[model samples]
Target: MTDTVLVTYGTTNGSTAQIAEAVADILRKDGLTVESRPARSVTGVAPYGAVVVGGALYAGRWHKDARRFVRRHRVELAERPVWFFSSGPLDASAAERDIPPVRGVQRTMVRLDVREHVTFGGRLEEGAKGRMAGMILRSGKGGDFRDFGAIEAWAHRIAEALAHT
Candidate 1:
């Protein structure tokens, strides 16, 4: 496989997309060719040597697009290195500890023999889409809780792992 990596994500208010871009940036800096794209827009995974798929959480489940991306590309992904991340939890919990992957993500990881998985803090702010987002904002729970330092560190780990492979 070539040293090309695909970083893709499913996002609601665009926060998860930002996280994916950050990961792609780090991978690129590590001298890997990287491509960042929305999960819904990717048609195939065959061209990538490695893949990082991230999803935004909503009510304890992954975004529809991320779930669909995994399901559709399961075959191709199994043949290469794959990592998964979830961005949700508008709190500092993710930064403070190792947030375990939800059931669906866990199952996918096991089935695909995924390299690793992580749960990063999420972001919710004004102008977010969806009724639940508006409700959360009204309840004063909306905020940016993503920790870029942790995200970059994780990407560095991925880059290191890629180097050995």
Candidate 2:
């Protein structure tokens, strides 16, 4: 069986992509083959033994491309091990907020029997384009808040799970 794992993500300003790459790197370090791609660019999932899908969160919802990817691949994903992640939350406190998964994602999770969903802290660059994001950035709260240690720990856990599977 192919041991390749697919790490795909959706991002508006690239923070989510960075997180996805970090996860992929950790998995690769554990001796697994990893392929990383943007959600919209991924054509199929059959070649992968496991799938890790991630997206940037906005207004309590996942990026549209990521959501669409889940909807399109729910069946194949159900047949394999699947994990989901959202990259949002401006700070540690935001990361601790008890935000519920968006309805679409929740439905997809049930359909795919997803193993886990992790939400990581996000970054907001000052010159980001969106009006809402721009306004938030003006408030001087925007900066990289990603917890790399936590992200690596989660990836290691995934690697362990894959080893047993």
Candidate 3:
């Protein structure tokens, strides 16, 4: 029987949501069942064999909803395979650094025995809806920095790991 994986994320400007959807598509293409949803909307992880939790990173922290989701579903997540991803760091150099998860996220990562945590380059569009986000985007470092090929490669790795598990 095929196992279902849940790819849930919290996105500020929708870039992270796109990444989550890309992940779900890759998993599905690899013959696994997948569900992609926003972090705040996911009520439970009980139905999934594996879970991928992601969020937009701002000021070196994950979005609040993603952090809360992990905290609220700590026990259930601990009982299954869980992976975490942070989509941010518009600066290319920043993406190369091994950025650590925020304090609250760190605690939950420990509790859940998170399989992996990836930091991907993010997109920042000028004049976006968010106030601070717009200010940042206007700083002359905004463009589509997302590396789709890298994202797909990572998703393939996840698919391989899930297949073995």
Instruction: Summing lDDT over every window of 10 consecutive residues in candidate 2, give the lowest-scoring window.
Output: 93-102
Candidate 2, clashing residue pairs? none
Regions more than 4 Å wrong, model 1:
none
Measured against the true structure, the TM-scores of the candidates, in listed sequence, are: 0.98, 0.93, 0.92
Q: Ten-residue segment with the worst summed lDDT in candidate 1? A: 1-10
lDDT of 3 by residue, 1-165 (tens): 337899999887899999999999999999999999999999999999999999998887898889888878888999989998888878774345666776666777887799888788888886566877777766787877777887898899999999898
Number of backbone collisions per candidate, in order?
0, 0, 0
What C-alpha lDDT does candidate 1 achieve relative to the native structure?
0.94
Off by over 4 Å in 2: 94-100
Which candidate tops lDDT?
A: 1
- Tens digit of lDDT per residue, candidate 1, span 1-165? 247899999998999999999999998888889999999999999889999999999999999999999999999999999999999998889999998999999999999999999999999999999999999999999899999999999999999999988
Better candidate number, 1 or 2, judged by TM-score: 1
Each candidate: what lDDT?
Answer: 0.94, 0.88, 0.85
lDDT of 2 by residue, 1-165 (tens): 338999999899999999999999999999999999999999999999999999899888899989988888878989999998888888885456645566777788888899988888889987776998988898887999898988899899999999999
Quote the positional error of residue 37 for candidate 1 in Å.
0.4
Local lDDT at 142 for model 3: 81
For TM-score, candidate 1 versus 3, the one ahead is: 1
